[model samples]
Target chain A: MSFLAAASTNINPGLKAMGYGLSAIGPGIGVGIVFGQGVNAIARQPELTSTIRTNMLLGFAFSEALALIGLVAPFIYTS
Target chain B: MSFLAAASTNINPGLKAMGYGLSAIGPGIGVGIVFGQGVNAIARQPELTSTIRTNMLLGFAFSEALALIGLVAPFIYTS
Candidate 1:
């Protein structure tokens, strides 16, 4: 019983870390979609490239923030 | 001691959720900025509107992904 309990306890942190890693998946996919679309738009309208680029960067920044949260979650929870 | 420990553990989830929620703010603002600039670009150069719109949408999707990640973070952590 004691050994089982110890093993489970050790597994818990790994599970939690895996969760955090998995949580990042959504943001990763989303950001890619956003950029892909942004590029498509720019390609269609070369004249407005500057504006498109600016917006794309801004959106990219935001999407990246979510991953940052995922990275921080485990520390916050365990602490 | 047990009560304090339980209370802290209970509070931990909330904190994690809040962190996730806070993480979304960046993406929200980022997407808005992206759309705003995209619109402005389209307005300035009507001929390239189609291209600009497409790019904008793509960027928007990516930015929104971040929020999705935030939404999933809590569930992943707790599970």
Candidate 2:
């Protein structure tokens, strides 16, 4: 039991950054999808490229907001 | 053993934010998927732009709601 306790003790509890990292993953993927699909749409209809780009930027902003929120959540929830 | 205990005591048990972070991921990706597809659909049929945009916004709201819930979850689950 002492050995187990000693091993566990070595683990750090500064996992707030880990939480931010985890939250960033989803938004990262989300932003990627928005741009990827936007590019595909532009390619299919070059005339609509501007419109597709506008939509992609809007989507990126919305999705990226979540990751930013994650960054702030730890500070907000001190418990 | 005393040294080990002392070291462990310095570590925090604040993993609530981590749970919220994990929960945000799915919805973030969901919102991305909705917008990505919506843009692609609009490219295919520009005439349906309004309809697609409406659907996309609605879907985004639904998906984003999940992330918002995650933000509040840490407070609700204090254990």
Identify the candidate with maximal TM-score: 2
Stretches of candidate 2 above 4 Å error? A1-13, B1-13
> What's the TM-score of every candidate structure?
0.53, 0.83
Model 2 B-chain TM: 0.79
CAPRI-style quality class for the chain A–B interface of candidate 1: incorrect
lDDT of 1 by residue, A1-79 (tens): 1222221223344445444545555565556555655655665578677887788678767856767776676767654
Which runs in model 1 stand beyond 4 Å of their true positions?
A: A1-79, B1-9
For residues B1-79, what per-residue lDDT tens digits would candidate 1 score against the true structure? 1222221133455555555556566566656666766676666667776766776776677667666665665565543
Q: What's the lDDT for residue A53 in model 1?
A: 77
User: What is the DockQ (computed on Cα atoms) for candidate 1?
Assistant: 0.09
On a 0 to 100 scale, what is the lDDT of residue A57 in model 2?
91
Clashing pairs in 2: none
TM-score of 1: 0.53
